[model samples]
Target chain A: MVQLDDLDRAILKLLKQDARLTISELAERLNRPESTIHFRIKKLIEKGVIDRYTIILGEPLKPKSVVAVYIETEIPVIEDFLEKYINHITKTLSMLPNVLAVARSGRNGIIALIGGETEEQIEKFVDDTIRTLPSLRKVEVFPFTNIVKGEDVIGFLVDV
Target chain B: MVQLDDLDRAILKLLKQDARLTISELAERLNRPESTIHFRIKKLIEKGVIDRYTIILGEPLKPKSVVAVYIETEIPVIEDFLEKYINHITKTLSMLPNVLAVARSGRNGIIALIGGETEEQIEKFVDDTIRTLPSLRKVEVFPFTNIVKGEDVIGFLVDV
Candidate 1:
């Protein structure tokens, strides 16, 4: 198990909010000595408790409309063909810029997050790109309206 | 539309990868002058193109299993209760540490992302916490087997 004390968690919580905090600022905010704060951060990084830093794009780069698509492909009799087909579809979807995220649900199920400038555009993409694929047994599109929690996730997951 | 040229896109892409890069390093890597890179970043922030700086926690802090739950609530006879009930449920779910993301899918539907130590734990959470809620017409849980795209999203959204 990952053992984290109160100090470690406090530092992580602050960093999670703003990664640009310097050692001095962190020390001041957390009421810890500068040396101790610096050492703790170094240890956290070394232990892989703090992953590599990255940036989240803002609204200017985010899509205006988003949809979560759940797709289930028909299991071919060959069984071997099922695995290959699933891999092929997942790889193809992952390469698209509009597809923000994609993950396999089960044996033949795939869930994808797609974004666009407008609902019509998203619908068109789903029709042209997703529905056109062969061997699809089920496709359900859930339109995401108001994101009450994790509202910034769209900006975070969007590619530059 | 937000007008961004090649230089702007290049800088944004690099920053998205690593926001810790200094202006001089970014200019050197992108073959632009330091002054130009500095000005561009300043403008980007002013234009709200950069959004905000944040951190992604490492695997040590991440949950071992995650699932996306889709819920549709039954419309009540009162009609007025629908909105209030949905809001109540969403707020309640959002407050839980295990519930990572929550959004209103439609007028009577909700979508949430939940994480736990194992599949059984997640299942128990859904059954004990979510399934027991009143007015729920349907509940579907989709386990994330393997994320092919936007893999860092989990770490990025996880709270410290």
Candidate 2:
């Protein structure tokens, strides 16, 4: 674990909120000297604490509806076939623009975040694109009706 | 829907990769004048396509294990009670640092992304903190063994 003082945490919190803040602005807000703020940020980057800077695209570009789908593939007779099948499914989903995120969940399961213009549209895509895939044991869809925390994630993960 | 020309999308894509890029750099890369790059970025910000600049924390700060949990509450005799219960559950979970994200799945269901140092630790958290809650109909945990796309999201959403 990395050790972080209160100042480091404060700077990280501020930068996470708005990375556009200049060193002088951060100094003024945190009551630290400009040099200290700059040094701290540099150290944070060097330590790999601050991974990267990026932009979150806002509404109109963000999907109006999002759903989390859990797909469980049937265990094939050949063990090698199951591993290959899971890899193929994840790669295929990752290439699609509508599939915002994809991950392998345990041995025979995959979880994906899918986005669309409407609930109906997303459901149709799930039924047509996902449910149609062969050798799947079950597919469950969880629609995000209201995001209470980390709501900006959709904006962060959406494709431009 | 917001209209985005090829240039706007290209600019957005580059910025999304690295928001710290200077206007001159963007211009040089895109074969456009610096003034044009500057103008386009300004317009993009003004139009709210670029929501905000942010940072993604690296490995040490990010959780080593992550799981997506779906919690469904049992419906009560009073609809009002169910509404308030769901709200209360979401609010409580949102306040926890380990609960990376929380969203209402439906009238009586909640979807939360949880993080911890290990899978066992996260399971303990779910067993102790979440499953203990009264009136839950079901609790499902999906472990993300491998994230194939949009994996940086964990870094983006993880709290300091």
Candidate 3:
């Protein structure tokens, strides 16, 4: 089990906001010695607490509208094909750039986040591509009108 | 409109994978001169194409179970209170550490991603915190059995 002290949590919080912060900058902000900050960061990475450094894209690259499409496939008589069918759907959805994320819910369901230029476009894509897929029983689209929390997710998940 | 040529897109893609990559490292990988890579990165930052550098926490800090909860509120007769009611709900959910993301869906709906130590904990949270809220028409929970794409989202959105 990994136990994080107050200092570790604080360092993580700061890095989550801006990983580019130098050891000196982190030390200044946290009121700690630069060497201490450096050593802690190294340990965190080694322990697999800090996975990797990355970037969040800006508005220019993000889509104007976004929606989460939940699709539940009707169970087939064969039963053995359920996993294959789900895999196919997930793989096909994963290939599309507009589909930011794809996940399986239970044995017969798939949930995906998709983005487009407008609400109409997203709806159309869902209707044309997702709904038309075979064996799907339910397709629900939840439009993201305004994100109050974790608002930058679209930017983080958007493809360059 | 901002236009991204092949070189700009390539640089952005590489940086998205590893923002900590040095200019020389990026140049080496992209087969471009170090100076050219530096100049392009500078311009990308200036143009707001590269929003900000950040970090993704590893699995140790991320929740073991995740779910997307979709809640739809019943439209009130007064009509004017819907916005306030929705805003109040979103703000409240946003304050909780377990609620990873909150987004408004149309006028009467809100979608939230939540995380917990176990599936039972997440269910209990929804039953206690979400379903008990007034004027809710529907509450749907989609458990993430397997994430095929954007799997690190929970780690990225998890609070320190």
Candidate 4:
């Protein structure tokens, strides 16, 4: 297991807020030497902690409906099922093109985010996207009434 | 940004699979010494790379029809509404207790995963849990047809 100290905690909190922050900027925020921040980040990469640095794009508000999806399936519950089916589902979902992020839960369901220009457009988008899934038994799409938080990914990691 | 080598990528991929691995065990898999592995993890922690350790709990295959919800809502076109509503939506969705994950694609929509024991049970659960959101003006529910990728957290991150 990895152990984290106060500085580490602060640094992570900062990065969670802004991964694009440069080493000098991060060090300045944490009141540390730029060299120290750079070295620490390097070690973190070597240890497999920081996976990668990528941009999180904001979707076009062109769509008026924000949809929330819940899923359940009837698969033969077994390890072989997990090993074989996991890859297929992952590939297909990743191909959604409009999907923002897909995450796993403690239950046998997936949450998907998609966008469109209107209620009908969003509905059609949902219909077509769900149809692309092969083993899916049932899927529910609930368009969001509102999003209280977006783009901010650190909420789960810390108390704001 | 942290510069990564192949070894660093390997470490990240492995740990992303399972964060519960012991330092010594991680070293064996990475073909590195325990001390080196330990140091790398420490450095990663200090750099805010690995956020924290957490357990993903999936309910023991219960008897509910999984529902996927898509929410389309209105947001300020010029301003950032992702954080405002996303936070609120996440808070509400999380409060449902049955909700596993809530994800959004900016202002266009929010995708949420919810589980229950039966179709009716899931329906009631959604009605009781989500109907109260003040910002949500409309909603659409799609019972999962088949899970395409289910939850691909590791698959989304790892090369293997």
Worst 10 residues of 4 chain B by lDDT: B151-160
TM-score of chain B of each: 0.98, 0.98, 0.97, 0.64
Clashing pairs in 2: none
lDDT computed for candidate 3? 0.93
TM-score of 2: 0.99
Q: Which stretches of candidate 1 lie over 4 Å from their true place?
A: none
Fnat per model, in the order given?
A: 0.85, 0.93, 0.90, 0.02
The best candidate by TM-score is: 2
lDDT of 4 at B127: 80
lDDT tens digits, residue span B24-134, model 2: 999999999999999988988888899999999999899999999999999999999999999999999999999999999979999999999999999999999999999
Write the residue-wise lDDT of candidate 1 on A1-160 in tens digits: 6788999999988887778889999999989999999999899988888887767788899999998999999988999999999999999999999999999998999999999998789989999999999999999888899899899899888987
Checking candidate 3 for backbone clashes, the offending pairs are none
Residue-level lDDT for B26 in candidate 2: 95
Number of the top-ranking candidate, with DockQ as the measure: 2
Candidate with best lDDT: 2
In candidate 4, stretches whose alpha carbon ends up further than 4 angstroms from where it belongs are A1-160, B58-65, B72-92, B103-110, B128-137, B145-160
> What is the docking quality class of candidate 2?
high
lDDT accuracy of residue B152 in candidate 1: 87
* All models, RMSD in angstroms: 1.1, 0.7, 0.9, 12.5
Residue A125's lDDT within candidate 3 is: 98
How accurately is candidate 4 docked according to DockQ? 0.05
lDDT (Cα, tens digit) per residue for candidate 4, span A16-125: 45564778998988899998898887766565555544322122112345454555555656858854564555566657645544543323455565555565776786
The DockQ value obtained for model 1 is 0.82
The regions of model 3 sitting more than 4 angstroms off are none
